[model samples]
Each structure stands twice: as C-alpha cells, then as structure tokens.
Target: MSIPGEGHEDVRADEQKDGRKAGGYGLHERANPKRHRVIRLWTVVHPSVLGSTTLTATASEAPLTARLYPRNWRGDGVPSFKPSGQKGWPIRGQDLVRLSADYWWVIGVGVVLTLARFSEAFLVLKGRAAGLPLALVPVVMVVMNVVYAATSAPAGALSDRIGRRPVLVAGLAALACADLALALMPGLAGLFVGVSLWGLYMWLTQGLLSALVADTAPEDLRGTAFGIFNLATAAALLAASGIAGLFWDRYGPSSTFLVGAVFAALAAAGLTLRRRQA
Candidate 1:
C-alpha cells in the first residue's frame, strides 16, 4: 500500500448503498519488485529539490531586461531637464544622460532570467502529475497565460511610480519567497502560485527599463542613448538563452531557478552600488 492513486497500491475502497465498502476492487499496480523495503532515493530527492523548478524559471527570464533598457550613444545636444516629482531620486538625472554601461545592471538581470525560462517546461511536467483531465490542461494553460500577461505590466509600472530601486528590490525579494514555496509544496497548486508570481516579477522589466532610460538620457540624445543600451542588452540575452538552456539540460531544472535567485540577489545588491556611488 504505497499510497492510493500512486504506484504499488493494489486495493481500492468503494462505498455501497449501505455506507460500507462492498464492491472494493483490486487496482492493478505493477510494483517495482526491488521492494527490499528500501525507498527509492529519487523519491526523496524530489522533495529536497522541489523548489528547483522556480529557480529554473527565474534564470530563463533574465535576458528580457536587457532588450527593454537599451542604450543610445550617438545622439547629440542636451535635452532640457525639468524638475518634477520628488527632487531627491537618484534616477532623476538618469533620464537624460546617455551611456550603454550605465544600465548594465539591468542586463545582468536579463541573463539570469533567460536561464529561468527553461523552468517553464519543468513546471509543465509537474502539471502532468496532477491527474487533471488531459483535455482541460490546454485550457488551463491558456487561461494562465492571460493571467500572467495581465499581471506583469502593473508590477513594473508600480515600481516606477513608487521608486525604481524599491520596486526592483521588492520584486526580487518576492521572487525569492516564491522560489522557496516552489521547493516546499507537494502539489500542482504550489507550481501555480510560484510560477504566477514569478511571471509578475518577470514583468517588471518593461517599466523599470523605460524609467531607467527616462532618468538617464538627455532629450536631445535619445536616439544614440537608446541604441547603445539596447545593443548590450541583446548581447546578454543571446548568451543567457544559449547558456541557460545548456545548464538546465546538464543539471536539473531546479538548479536553473536557483541560479536565478542568486542573480536576482546580485542585481539587488548592484542597485545599492549606485546609491553609494552617488
């Protein structure tokens, strides 16, 4: 009796009109005869690394950030700067300055996220085990995609309105929590929650990067400013997609998401660097 609905369980209980098990039948389960009472190590391994899939998810989303931030280096003339909003924000000047490397930190986040994308596949695999109707899986997936699309933009926008550093850092921190949840839960619901929040955090790039450009580039030089920023980001994404795939195939899925958490930490840490320097 190795748990019902799983392997090695040969009996089932069915209730009758009398409220007693009458038509109970034997469930055909092909037991692994290596049943020397020793549990398979792989079974244990899964619980230990359950959260690994989320890390994989996070790693793969890294590259998108680079594409959104883009640098332009060849434009000329100073764009007029008007004082608006809070006067003390660091990014107040990042709006008009033009430098590719100025936003390099965003590129780094992209690398880790691109790697996390592979985690998406593993997350799907987890779905297969849920015993959900095969016919409904496709529908569930479509619905979920819509949910993600709806949620991502707002997360990024919220960060911008509130403050870039705080939003970026908070999203990463929430991701860290989501990753842990992925590792600990024993069912599909865990994957759903983790992946959904993961998507929301991933969505932060568009607004965050847009603000990065706004804060740094001069109005007169927006063309050159955007060009240079985008180029570097594209390069990081190219590397992240290729290498992150390799990492996922060679190691386990969870390893990919784990790497994502590390990169997120590094990015969060890097955000601090600008404040100290300024």
Candidate 2:
C-alpha cells in the first residue's frame, strides 16, 4: 500500500486548525475561564523570506474595525458619514414670523413713541422760539438729559414691580402733555417744562422697551429681537421728523407739536386697548 506523505498531511492539518481558530474567535470568545482569553476573527497572512505564505490566528479583547482606521472612522470605530465644519450664524426671514404678538406689540409701541418724540433738534428750536436766550437754549437738553439719567433706572425698577404696559401708557400720556405744553404755552417756561416732560417720557419708555423685548424673546434670539426693535423705531423716528418738518414749515411749530400730541394720545389709547384684550 502506498503511504500518504507525512509533510503534506501535517501542512493540511495546520491549515484546517488555523481555519477553525479564525471562525471560532470571530463569533465568540474562547471557553477558557481561568485565563480570561479574548478571541477575535482574523485572516492574517504573512509572506516569509523563504517565499512561503503562512496563516495564523490569535486572540484579542478589542475589535479592529474602528481602531484600525482612526482617521477615516468615527470615535465609535464606524466610518464617519457626517459633513465636516459648520457655517456662520445668520438671521433668516423665518425669524421675523417666529416673533410672538407681545414682542410685536413692544416693537410697535416703540415705533409709535419714537415718531411722536421726533428729534431734540426740534426741541432746541422750540426753546429758541419760546424766547429762550441762544445760550440758555442748550439748557433745555441739559435738563432733559439730567432727568433722563436720574429716572431711567428707577422707571425700569418700577415697571418690574407694576408691569411694563402701565408704565408705557403713562409715559405716552406724559408725552402728550409735553407736546400740548409746547404747542399751547408761549414762554421760556413752557419750553423748559415741555422738555422736562420729554425727559420723563424717555426715562419711562426706553429701558422698559428693552426689558419688554427681553421678556418676550427667546433667550437665544434676544439680541436679534432688540436689533429689530431698534431698527423699526429708528426708521419711524426719521420719517416722523420729515413729516414734522413739513408741518412746521407750512403751518408753524404749533401744528407740528399738536400733531405729536395727537400721535402720543393715540399710542396711549392703543396700549390701553391691548392691555384690556390681554
């Protein structure tokens, strides 16, 4: 009988053993409890200097799928599928529609108030027209600014306790009185008093408007809300001055002041209506 070659049989047995080791480790760990051995599936092939290929199997506790490709894969070892980097922040049109009614109310009231107030340049001109000495005319602004600086913090604090709407309505009503004082009275005294009242209105409304915007806006979007609020009121104020100037040139300063009074009165009435609705 012809006998099988011993070297060929040994090589075939070794190949079979390596295949079994690879398969068993790929599915689960080894059953040796004492050694705590970890088994992993691998198809390891190495070419030796002798021009022979060798196959080998080994046990390892860690998986190679993620760790082996650090740059190409995610932290968890899976290939990264997310896009790299991010774009800069931008305010979209959807931001306008997302603002609430109360926020819009605050912005609207601010715009109306700004329109009625007009520019302090007109206030200085009114002082001069009321027979104020040219040098003393600037005192009108000084007094108003002093009053504004003093009362601004107090007005904001009072609104925090009593609520923003009441304070804003009161300020608008005071603004109406100031406008009427400037229109109807005929002396330096009227200019001073009207300008003082103007300062009072600034104290009452400006900081409070900021607070209302903060209260109504989402925390993340508060800055954007304030920017919108300021922009709307600023544009209104510019338009209002142009309109007031037209009235002043055609009908006189009294007509301009009278119109401002009317606007302030209307704003107050609207605020009252909104409060009732709320």
Candidate 3:
C-alpha cells in the first residue's frame, strides 16, 4: 500500500500550479489537507485513548485536584437509565401538603426569617438617609458583601461542628441587633455597623437553612422540600418588602427597621421554643 501522505507533496504542487496555496499546518479549517486527514484518521483509530487522555488531564488539573485523582478510581458497573414520567399537580400538591405538615417548623423558620429581612435596597436607602453621599451609597452594599463573603465559610464550618439550630439562633440575634442599630443609632457609623451585622446574619443563616432542609428531607423528596421552602420564603419576602415600603413611606425608616427587629425577635423565640420541645 502507498504511504498515507505520500501524494500530499504532489497534491500541493498541483494546487500551487492551479494558483491555490496549500494552507499552513494548523488544526483550523484552513489547515493543510493531508495533516487534517491524518488527524481525523488517528482520532477514528484511537478514539478512547484520545478521550481518556483529555479527561485524565482535565481531572488532574482541576480545582481541588488532590481529591479528584482518587487512587482507586474505577468504572466497573453498568449505569442504569430509566424514563421517568412527569409528576402531575395533584401528586405535587400532596407532597407539598405532606412536607408542610412534617416539617412545619423548618418551613416556619424560613418564612419568619424571610419576613424579618427585607431587600438590601432598604439598607442603601437607610445609608442615604444617614447622610451618605449619593455616589458613596454603593459602598454600603460593598461592605456588607465583603463581611458576608469573608465569614460565610467559617460560619458554615462552625455550624457543621456545633449543629445548625444554635448557629441559626445566633444569626437571628444578629439580624435583630442589625435592625436595632439601623433603627435607633445615628450617622454613617451606625449604618456601617448595621450593614456589617446584616452581613453576619446572612453568613450565619443562609447556608445553614439549606443544610437543615437537606438534613430533614427524605432523599426522594429533597427537591420537593427545597421547592416548597423556597416558595414559602419568597412569598414571605415579598410581603415583608411591601410592608416595609408602607412603613418607609408612612412612618419612616426607623419604623421599617423596628418592624424587622420585632419579627426577628419573634422568630428567634419561636426557634428556641421549638428546640426545647424537640
């Protein structure tokens, strides 16, 4: 048999004579025809080798690389696939009801906590009211997010070690304190303190609640549990914001924050009572 690329030189010569260049040796569409053909043939012949090499390199270099490269990595069993039917509203409604009944306290905490915290936009408004410059108002959220990002990992780790309830209680307390500071204290310093506390509250509570939902939910109903929990909390947040806006327009910022503080206190008390009962 003739060598695979033996006629490539003659083909190039013909192309040149016909006023067409043989294109450069690259992997793109305009690459040398013979080299591209050889690459395609090699891939066809050793498809698994090429794919596995790429996968191995990717896994080895990915983040948390040490964990990715397991010493006993193996694929011995065949994966089972099944066609699942869509769940109807009736079935989903029944699940929602069951989840509500079984995990009422978890759902309750989520609702009350959401109600206790309005949109962060209110915080920016509060900062503005406190004499923060229009341009520098964005700094309020920046500081809050910085504290939140800095502490969230540590808070999650602590909750994992100590348990979710106590950590959540502390978070509610932080929220109450934040609301108190925002409502009662004066000036930008107070705004920053409240903002920081708000960040701490978020860092402490948000992840813990998700972990709590996962812990309490049945494996088969985890997705349903999350769906219902999110729905309830979202509704509560909407209502809370509406109420806060009413208070802001009618009474003032202090009343708005004070209302949030009251709700936070009530939620914390409810959680403590629930824990004792449990």
Which candidate gets the maximum TM-score versus the true structure?
3
After superposition, which runs of candidate 3 have C-alpha atoms over 4 Å from their true positions? Answer: 1-81, 90-102
Per-residue error for 22 in candidate 1, Å, reads 59
Across 39-117, the per-residue lDDT of candidate 3 in tens digits comes to 8888787978888988888764424423454432334322233346676663466665556343768888888988899
Candidate 1 similarity to native, TM-score: 0.51
TM-score of 2: 0.65
lDDT of model 2 at position 180: 92
The residue ranges of model 2 lying beyond 4 angstroms of the native Cα positions read 1-89
C-alpha-based local distance difference test score of model 2? 0.81
State each candidate's clash count. 50, 1, 0
Taking the tens digit of each residue's C-alpha lDDT, what string does model 1 give over 1-278?
Answer: 24446532333332233234232221111244354224466676777686788677776452443445434211232223435556553333454344445555544554444333334554454455444466655643554466668877567557747878677666666566555555555566766776666665656544565567656655656665566556656676666556556655787545545665666666666666765676
lDDT of 1 at 12: 35
Distance from true location, Cα of 120 in model 2, Å: 0.7
Listed in order, each prediction's TM-score against the native is 0.51, 0.65, 0.70
Q: Model 1, stretches more than 4 Å misplaced?
A: 1-101, 104-146, 149-157
User: Which one wins on lDDT?
Assistant: 3
Q: Write down the worst ten-residue block by lDDT for model 2.
A: 38-47
lDDT (C-alpha, whole model) for all candidates: 0.56, 0.81, 0.84
Candidate 2 residue-wise lDDT, 12-114, digit = tens: 7788899999988655544553343321112132224223421223233224645654666765545775754546765667887778898898788778877
State model 1's lDDT: 0.56
